[model samples]
Target chain A: MMHPSAGGVLKPACYAKPLLRPFGLAWIVMMSVAATTQAAPEALAQVDPPTADHSQFEPLQQDFASGREVTRACLECHTEAGKQVRASIHWRWEYRHPQTGQLLGKQHVVNSFCNNVTTNLGRCTACHAGYGWDGPDFDFSDDSRVDCLVCHDTTGTYEKAPKRGGRVLQEPVKVHGHPLQPPDLGKVARNVGPTSSETCGSCHFFGGGGNGSKHGDLDTSLLDPPPALDVHMSDAGAGLECSDCHVERAHQIAGSRYQVTARDRKGTGAPGQRRYAATCASCHGIEPHPLGSDPAALYQGAKLNAHVDRIACQTCHIPAMARGGVATKTWWDWSKAGRLDADGNPVKRHDADGNLTYWTRWGEIEWGEDLEPDYRWFDGTMRYTLPDQTIDPSAPVPINRFAGHHGDPAARIWPFKMMRGKQPYDPVKDRLVYMQLFGKTEQAYWQGLEWQPAIASAMEAAGLPFSGEVSFTETRMAWPITHMVAPAEDALACGECHARDGRMAELTGFYLPGRDSDPALDRWAQLALAAALLAIGLHIGLRILFHRRRRHTE
Target chain B: MTRTVVMFTGLERLWHWSQALLIILLLMTGFEVHGSYSLLGFGTAATLHVLAALALIVVWIFAIFWHLATGEWRQYRPTTRGLAAVVRFYLYGMFRGESHPFNPRPKRKHNPLQAASYLLFGVVISPLLWITGLLYLGIDLWSAPADLPLAPIALIHVAAAYGAALFLLVHGYMITTGRTPTAHLKTMITGREEIEEASQREQQPERG
Candidate 1:
């Protein structure tokens, strides 16, 4: 429960103690709040309170040397736990998008980060749920393979060693000249309980190789955010768990970054209550403003509702994300990677916020905080370029392209974090290659330092013929910002949208009164009004002259 | 002999002033909605504009029924017999101390210019303003297609506004051109005007 403090102080020693659980009486209030927003992981759907402690059980009483050995003993009591984990998307790294039919997930899609996990399973599977998926021969049907402790471990000591085929290291080793401690498997096995934010945030908060590298909205700051930082996640405020709105059933979480809810034709559940869609509209209807308060309410409600036909809820609600003071990765230039320091070791540099700004193994990097999102109409669909798909070598490739614009009826303008990366791509074959990133053989990019053989071996394993020609291609990807929702009072003011140079000026296509003006129409209207006034002037002059003439004649 | 001529009924004066007040209110709020000037926020301005327009329409309906039921529509009937003289009087004859050529009667009250101006105001400008305003409100409320060209509709509506504005300007001067500067205004308030006995008896109005 020691979600590292938002002040950038990460202390593993502080996390060993168990936090105050959503205890006896407050547990009810926390459950009621879960219907809308509650970050307490125990508030997740269908979660049951434990009847007996695992430490008291004879199965977990024995000392275990490996996580797999611990898993075998736990299966004797909880027979169905490992089977449920195997069926989750967390196990199967591929998901078929319901709307686009595009097969995407950590396995099927090719992103600028670590490219693909094909040849890098040793290091990448540190985040994977099952063991021995190093070369895709791992059995999906094995129930004993799922690591239930990854999510269920209440003990703070469970740590998986990177580059070990997803196994917890049983021995201490040095990593980049730093001493490492092996996780105590026997202690972790005895302490299994309902998941907490710390357990889920373990892999999620440090994605894309470092803290706040992949997802802009998530970072160490969310561990213990304030109401001003994130109203929903702040333990001081709503204290919502990620699984509350992203309600999980069995093991499949409701929300996905791969597929999102752009517009909710189905309005909110109830006033001030939450739904399980992980969307603002799941809690607040399109008509967010109260009606019948004034005569304008009807027109205002309709006007705001009309905007929902093309703009997303996050466009206004999450004005700027990554505001929790932890900087997110904004740019990555892989072309500059592989630069050695004075001692010929891998050079690594950090930014002011302690984010990885540069690394000899990766590239020149940029990190930023409180960033404004790039607004685009996204109808909840993203077109991804798969590992084997043909790419256009003539232009920069988009790892994932956001869809929709003004005229698209079903599309809504959503806010996104546009990340730019320079990665290796096959020029002659027009495809991206997965290098043997962590292997110690001559084909590994890190150990062998040979790009040609490394890519050839990777492409051969992926069932694609390599052209032997490689080029560093600039790539772009957009991640939508749907978190760090500000309070309603902090939402964009009218002048922000309706001014001469408004925030939505270029993004929105309409004749906004204050923002856009038709000079031709304006000129004509002004002339006609002037003519009417001029006619009145002529009438007065004529009347005065006639009156004076009459007086003279008399 | 004491002579008095009934110029306006109390209901007619009430309708005239109330309609004027409503139009003025509509104009104030309507311009703000158009972003021309800000008297109130757009949301409030647009609501007030629609409400005032609706009230004006209701008042117009009552006035129309009163004219038809009471046979007061006959007073606005035009004749070409003295049309040129009336025009000339407004132009130059008034400077030469000449009398108005047309005589007033209950059944045939307005001169050709007055009848023509009122006809255009009621049939053309008023109708155009009402149609466009309603169409705009309908579009805003999603009752009509949102893609309708609001620029042209607004242009026509604003033009009609100018027409009403012109009527107000000229009407202001005409009231002062009566027997005295305040004569027409006083008659509108009291429903009577002093006139020669012959003119008053020449026409006996069939009162409703």
Candidate 2:
């Protein structure tokens, strides 16, 4: 039974009313139900998750055969989603670096991996957030081409395979004489929701051809991490997602490596105010250690606190990388490729650690586990080598040169995974050439054997003159290792950096007491003290001699 | 009087010289480990220092047990009974050729100043060095305490080493105060010293 006073507005003022009022019980019940029905949507919107069940929607009930069709279906209600996706880095593959004002993007930057995105649209566009990007003329303005399922798919089966021209197969297809089933796109599109580790890892974890290759710290092991492996991401621990630190507003993710916030001094900024959101100092402030009054949390070392100025948080937090039972590629030599068996099939070799040291695919690879990162001064800005940039063949050309050097106030020594490559370049022009590493149709390199036709066709596609002269040149790139956070106990001990042969002994232009020597200064100080002592002894001997002479005279 | 007194037993001299050699070895490598100009490389210095510290500890154990078993520990008993006389002799009386107030015997080997300094070294400085050195050695091992104020602890250890070095200097200077400059130095090697036998009954062991 409902009271008339309580039923009128469902206000807190009428909650303690025990007696019925002048209105009828039937009318009160009817009015209360109507109020509840009206208030339901606002209550639903203000919870932990804002997403509703998409399968219940009438448009999503129909089967989706293509990624474009799924995008079309998604756009029926979310009319502005395609426009938002178009402006994102994931969609445009472009970012004008704020510090350098350089046109640095995945499409323009030539990396030391498979090199660049040019002349290999069909193979590279598999990870692109659009469909049918098979050629240079692929329309960027096509709203229906935006891929909603790649990031939104709740079903694990949704996939866009390489060499398929960014097309998702509707049915099972045979590849390399092995039958493979197509992902259930219809079920994935219908059940779209928040992104999981699997959705993000689909492209990120598998970067540079293998799991844990490009970023040694991030890999498939992060999918379901143990508490010790990643304290922040572990389900049994703090259980935070990537979106917690790399916060997103609208559709644009807040953090990026290219525009890194190397030193975040202003502390945490508002969602739109930050340059790069994923910084340790932003959340915990500059002095993070010995966080509170608790005994276990406090690593109360004076030296450790002083070291924060010169070294990045990742340098100490992540002592050894590729710790999740995976090896990262430390070397890639393309000059060793084209070694074929007697049957004309490409041959490969593996090292004692079972790392694919000699892979016929793309280059001769070398892997390392638990690698100590190479450190260098970086102030976030970097120079990307454009295809038009001329190279000096004498030295190993840095693909993306990390800017800043020792003694730069804005710079700090950051750990990076240095990859050395002997990749293809045009000898006559002295410029790096982007090769078509994989493609299925036409003059694609994977289908069409040898480098001559592939280089000619690829150069023609990219609108660059290849003098028909190709040679491998030595190149290197340093990718910063930022993830695979260990527990506080596993961090580097104080003595590891303060001991005689410490890790930071070779750090340039620095003077450390335990790791540095000043024999001249030490000797001088000791000699000064010894001389002072000798002077005191001589004064006493003189006093005694004077007193004895006085006594003899008396 | 040409009387001979056994100031140091053969075992006592053996322990004293062996401990001194080990301490010198420890300090050499210890300073090298501190990057105070390395003689032996860091790896060799660290290993040798640890080995020498362990040997010193073994020698200390035997010396302490022998002193307790043979009742020779009373030789270091500090007394203010003749302290004023000892100080005056060193300050003024020694220059005027005055008679000595205290003499070395089988049971009393140290003057008041020597006994006090030896006590400070054994009870305070040596223990501080041992505790800090052992704690530092356990680094990279499971026994190392987490959340320790390591820099301050290291500073304390270095300060203790400096204290030991200063003690060595003062000890070297004490040799010149003997009847002859080489009298005490020869006693440490030969375990005997020349003394007048005025009171033979006074050589009985007494509890400190």
Candidate 3:
């Protein structure tokens, strides 16, 4: 027998006593079944089930017109959540590096993909956690603008209109030939729960304008990865979501690219301990290999454990990035953009693999599937090339210089998805020029197909000087390869890095036994060995001749 | 008159043959680890090399104890006496079909030159190889002392490996210098060697 009082839902005032018991019992049973089917076992284990039946809440039950209206109602209960989120990097899009004191984040850094976010605020802010960030004057202190449902909505229908400054549209609209239907705001608000990979990936997975373009390690495939692709996040494996590793506290997420945990010696924390890092060591610990009872396994384990100090786990574990049937944008040539057909319309080209190779406005893009990552020595800190910073045009400029070397004790050899590009730079100023790549205005590069107006307008908006002359300069950005980790059995074999022309061949300042050898030493050793063999052969030859001569004389 | 004498004990022959097998295994695996040629693959070569080295160390421990306990250590106590004659015989007299300047007996198995070379290999080369090999294997256990990085250790280990190879090659050739080409090998295998009766009569009882 079900107790009517035990039901989470409140009995409506108009319901009669007889109807109340059955209705409450039926509602409870329906919710229980829904919860059982909706949440994965691992997700339920990590996150507590929602205690509040939000459908019964008076404010959420209303027909919400705007996202702000829903946020206001959410603030009525989660008062401090708004303030906490408003101060987060997701909202501010700014992070002042602790070591270098250089301000970086999505807001300040100019990426090769689409350049700066300044003139393309409406398009870029669609991913931002806040609302109404269409211009520089958008209020940062306004708590009501902080989006609660974006990260917390269990209703998968929640979506921000791409060009509407992170606002959920009330009316249906079409942009980029894809239909953008308005989400049921009341249902989304009422069903708000813990964030999952789907929620976090709604923005992150689609960064750099399209899916799997910005980060090779992150893609839509990670939403439901298989064991071979990512053992931790796979449904058949740990089934861990983004928040399981990128733990959040008071709206502040743990992981950041600006300051990476390149080498973690902290090891796995004790049970119930708060973790603030998404490093492999934080979960796998220092000794990750299995120390078997047998001798051979013990030897392998010890030898592998020895490498933990110098090599980051991802160097071997990840094997390759963009491995889940999604090709990552590896090369971008903005110089090749601005191509128009005979009709003066923008041109688009697709490759044999159905990948977009060229778009008139965006330029040529080279895709890579299951690509090997470039290795580098990294010690967490990354110094960015700020918009105002000058650069020498002699070589490819690094977008963010990794602050580490072979001599640095804290540094380890890390794997990175190297995104190489050729973008416009001011010849006179010797600095990278920002372009208004998106907008409806005639000055926008996508609309006008003119570089001068776009660069000038974006530079003016960013309060930076842009020389009239522009020249394309090669640039490189290194995104640390830390996700899509393969299983242990699929780790790199010894021969992969131990050969003469192997993965570590380009690495200098250190010596690897099979890969490196001193030519002079080798030549001398060979000579000495040959000499010894020759002397032994000559001595034996002389002895045989002497014995034969003596026998003939006798 | 030539007569067969007990030149090597059972334990000494066991140690010699087993040590030879271990060294051969070590050489094959060691060169592969140095990236000379990949026969058994690097991982397998490295593992086998360590296993052979460990086995060699165990054999050495037993051989050292046997040598000390039976007073056989005196055979390798290097002496200057007859050392010049032995050196000169190998350099000039051997090619001229001259008889060996040094004779082998039950108590004194090695010539002066052989004693000195064996002493150098036993005390210096062998110890160096073992210590460096262990250090290489136990690299995870200790932080290398200042001024001594892993490169030098690996280099020294390689150099010592070359020394071991040379020792094996020279030792192989030197065994052929016996009265018959296979005489020394036969003696090591059978624990007996044909020697002059007068030299055997002159042998004193061994003392530790």
Give the CA lDDT, 0 to 100, for residue A495 in model 3.
67
* lDDT of candidate 2 over A467-546, digit per residue (tens): 88888889888888778777666777645554667777667565444675455545664775587578559845865686
Model 1: chain B TM-score vs. truth? 0.86
The total of clashing pairs for model 1 equals 8
Q: Of 1 and 3, which scores higher on DockQ?
A: 3
Candidate 2: deviation at residue A525, Å? 7.8
Candidate 2, backbone clash total? 0
Candidate 1 ranges with C-alpha deviation above 4 Å: A1-58, A169-183, A267-276, A283-289, A292-310, A339-351, A393-396, A405-409, A441-443, A446-454, A498-500, A507-519, A530-554, B1-208
| lDDT values, one for every candidate | 0.71, 0.70, 0.81
Model 1, A521-552: lDDT tens per residue? 56776776678678767877877787787677
Docking class of 3: acceptable
What lDDT tens digits, residue by residue, belong to model 2 across residues B1-208?
4488788878889999999999889888888777776476654566577778878988999988998898877766767877887888776666665556677677677888788788788877888888877666543222367544344555566667766776776777677667765888999999898876757425644321
All candidates' TM-scores?
0.75, 0.66, 0.88
Q: Scoring model 2 with DockQ, what do you get?
A: 0.07
Looking at candidate 2 chain A, the ten consecutive residues that score lowest on lDDT are A14-23
